[model samples]
Target: MQRELIDGVPVLWAETPGPLEATLVFGCGVRDETFRTLGVTHLVEHLAMSTLPRLHFDHNASVDLALTQFTCTGRPEQVADFLERVCSALCALPLERIEREAGVLEAEGSGVADPTTAELLSIRYGTAGVGLASFGGPGPDRIPVEAVQDTVARFFHAQNAALVLTGAPPAGLRLPLPAGERPARATGQPVRQAGPAWQQAQVPGPGLALSCDLNDQAVFLAVQLLRQRLTEAVRHREGLTYDVGGDVVFVAPGRGERTICMEAREGQEQRVTELLWQEALRLATEEAPEAELAEEVEAAREVLLDPRAVEYELMEAAAELVLGDAPMRGRARLDLIEKLTPARLREAFAAALGSALLVVPCDIEVRPRRADGTELPQFSCGQGGELPTVGESSARP
Candidate 1:
């Protein structure tokens, strides 16, 4: 991987020796906006890429909590052309299509009910910053053209962006963006409460959800080990769930969120919750096996060495840069993973117990209580609606 500066924007290039694929990653995303203008960045993304459908290259745009990206795969020249056109389109966004795009956003929003992470975030961090994911962004109709333009000028600039190419540098690619400073990371507005709390939600099936603070490398390894243990107990042994896994999500600098989730069979919600806690307790007390840790490390190495990994890593680095974080290279990450000792992982698991949050079936009368025997908090619906019962379809918290 090589890093260069073109027109004052950082560009990361890797010669993967395959068909050309490139992505223009910007520092702006849902995290950059306020509750009043929540979906504005996404709206801008849609309008900016509206012209791509008419082009020959395969291309798309995505807006996540912390970044927006435009990606394309094609011949080098074709990819260059696509990116150039996108940069130009961003420079002068089509404000006339604001209403049209707003309709599109509304339609899109309707299809997606609240997601589990969004609900968790809302519970963890109120209805602003990261919590806006649960609240839904400001209505498109309320966002003005000037607001969109200002956001574009502030975030979609040379200093706040990076261009990553997988095959080779696209010839004659120009990022004609105006000068601007990198945008600051979003500061989440956390709810005024301590956790190790429990919450419940109504959904079609039973499931177990867990969240913990991402404090260090040990916490990350602990999350992975927890997922393995949960899968074994819930899916393989008890046959209570069909899906069981966990993921560590990047929230901000020196902070992350880990989630362990499982989908359960009908009438198995309470059992699944109990089993999950049992595993959690075991993990907290017992050390992870050396064999298991080695196996997981090898699996991670395989993923990092995969052909597609660099592209993903490059985009991740771009997002980290925007958040004022120095990205860890692949070698550094592997070294950390290699040094993960059973004792260190156990300590991390112990610390995770302090701030754990669990979500279970709302209708289940006997929910899993915290280890400390305290009452768990219930997450209310933002729309002033009643929580879903077991038989009804549940919306995200």
Candidate 2:
């Protein structure tokens, strides 16, 4: 892998011997938009790619809390052409179809009440920054053409962007970007809360959700280990849950949230929550066995070594660069994982549990409360009732 500047835009090129894959990643997404202007970046993304001619390749665009990415995979020439077309479309977005695009966005937003990430973040951080996921995209009709165009010019630029290629750089792949500086990282105004707090979500069946501030690789490994334990105890041993897993959401540099979830059987919500917390507390008290840690380390190393992982790392590196942080190389990451001891991981797990927030099924009354005996906050929306005001009864200490 090599880094260079192409037309003033940072580019990370990897000459891997595999199918060609290229992504144009920018430092703009949900975090860049305000509450009133929410979904502007997504709207722009939709408009920017609307004009691309169909090519025999896999191409798509996605928006997250802090990054927007356009990716294509196919023959080198095909990938290169698609990327160029995407850049051109971004530079000259067609606003004439604003109404049509707005309708499309509204339809997309109407299907789901709220994304799980958004719900969890709203409970932990509130409806700002990463928490805005709880707030559906501002309808296309509400966003002005000028705001969309201005966002494009400010964030989708040469300086705030990176091009990643899995094979070789494409010939004549010029990124026609306007001059602009990278926007600053978006910050979340997290709601103040004490830990082991519980919230409710409207969903079929029951599940247990947990969130904690991400500190380091040790915490990451701890989460992975905890997930494995929960799966074994909840799904295999007890047959109480059918699916149990977790994911990490990075809100900003050195700040992230990890969620562990379990989908429970009917009438088993209380048991599932109990088992989930049992696993967390066990991990906090006892160190993970050396063999279990080794297995996780090996699995992680395999993923990092895979050729396809380069594409993921490329985007991650670009996001890290935009956030003013250096991306950890694969070897360095493995080294950190390798050196992680059971005692260290236990400490990390305990710390995570100290600040963790738990979300359970809404129908189940007499649910688990916070460890400190504080009342657990409930997340109510249009379906549940009126939304709670900030720092209201739903807010925890």
Candidate 3:
């Protein structure tokens, strides 16, 4: 069913027909608070993300520059226990640099950690608007520890919180909310069809420069097709790696555009950058048989179905709503995947190519080269390691 009103925080609960693994996952997200507070939220999430390593259960949290998130997974009986603790942490964690927590916080924030593949990609993508240096966005070391503290002091609103329970929940286990009535828009989210955007991303990694080109609806579709094709060629066909995929998100929020990519065997570092680009180009320029599309779409469906395993199920459909109010469900997303007919897909690619943003996740320095193989070195990094440092990693201490 649908319910809302614990002093404004929206709560969504659903009972799906499936054997839940007796666990729950609650995700809390908030977009772009101060850089400092954002950092603190990261620290807070770390403080709570635990699963008794041995029990082999799942409990983790993440705070992105655009959003702060937390997820807890455990048996049904632990629902109340989990909820209480989570809420308590929400209410108690002091954003202030308390003397006791200082050592812990400093130690955590000071130590540096190797960049994840994703982090490497983020570093390459966070560029400025003028198409120049770092755009001061999230990257390997963009957000620092103080930024975490600053963000919480300013934006950590309780009402902005949400509690989602999927599996069997505790009887009457509700989030502690104030007395005022909740707004109507609180219960469910409204979804839109498309957004405005154009760009590409190049993530710095060792090997070939990997990039992502973004466009409108058509280009978005082409990107998805290219992702699947490459996954087939490099991953399944060549067994270079296990999985390979990318995303073309047509964000309608204030009309923004973004694309993401995943590769097999670290394709980002290969001299095969040209081949990868060619493959992406092919998705936009060439056409694939109907049978191939069918196979990949089926694979996509399987991915959509995997979440059924999580006891605390959050329909990705809904998350999209919260972020951008976009509905890619029912016939919408299906139509997107299906409508990328080879002929039409290429048209979409050509158009998007003009204003595309390329982000390749590799250490390969990008050299602008003409079709004739002439190298262009006009572009340069306005700065190096342009990320804000948050904290030192400590195995979750």
TM-score for all models, in order of appearance: 0.87, 0.86, 0.62
Estimate, for each residue in 1-397, the C-alpha lDDT of model 1 and write its tens digit.
7888877778888777678888888887776788788788988898888856587768888888777889989997888788888888989888899999999988887311236555566667776666666666558878988889989988998888888888657768788877897676655646735466667765433323334444365677777777787888888888988877554555667666676767678888788888877778677778888998888788878877787787777766776666665556666777887898998888877777767766666777654555466555544554557865768675999
Better of 1 and 3 by TM-score: 1
Q: 1-397 in candidate 2: lDDT tens per residue? A: 7887877878887777768888888888776777788888888889988898766778898887777889988987888788778888988889998778888888876321135545667677666777776676556689988898789878988888888888667777778877887676655656746465566775443333344445477888888887788888888898987777555666667667777766678898778878776677778888888999898888878987887777677777877777665657777777888899999989987877766677766777645544455665554443457766777364576
Give Cα distance to truth, residue 366, candidate 3, Å. Answer: 6.9
Candidate 3 structure quality by residue, lDDT tens digits, 1-397: 3544443445555565542222212222222332223234445555444322333345555543234455555565455555555555554455443433434545555311122223322343332111111222343134455665444444444434555556445566555422232211221111211111111334432211222232244555555567677667666676664554443222233333334344435643443344455575566556767776667666655654565533223444234433434434433555566556667767766555433334444355445343235542332344557566787766765
- 55 in model 1: Cα distance from truth in Å? 1.8
User: All models: lDDT?
Assistant: 0.73, 0.74, 0.42
Look at candidate 1 and give me any clashing residue pairs: none
Highest-lDDT candidate: 2
Q: Which runs of model 2 end up more than 4 angstroms from their true locations?
A: 110-114, 203-215, 366-397
**Per-prediction count of colliding residue pairs?**
0, 0, 48
- As a whole number from 0 to 100, the lDDT of residue 70 in candidate 3 is 51
For candidate 3, which ten residues in a row score worst on lDDT? 189-198
Which candidate would rank higher by lDDT, 1 or 3?
A: 1
lDDT of 1 at 147: 82
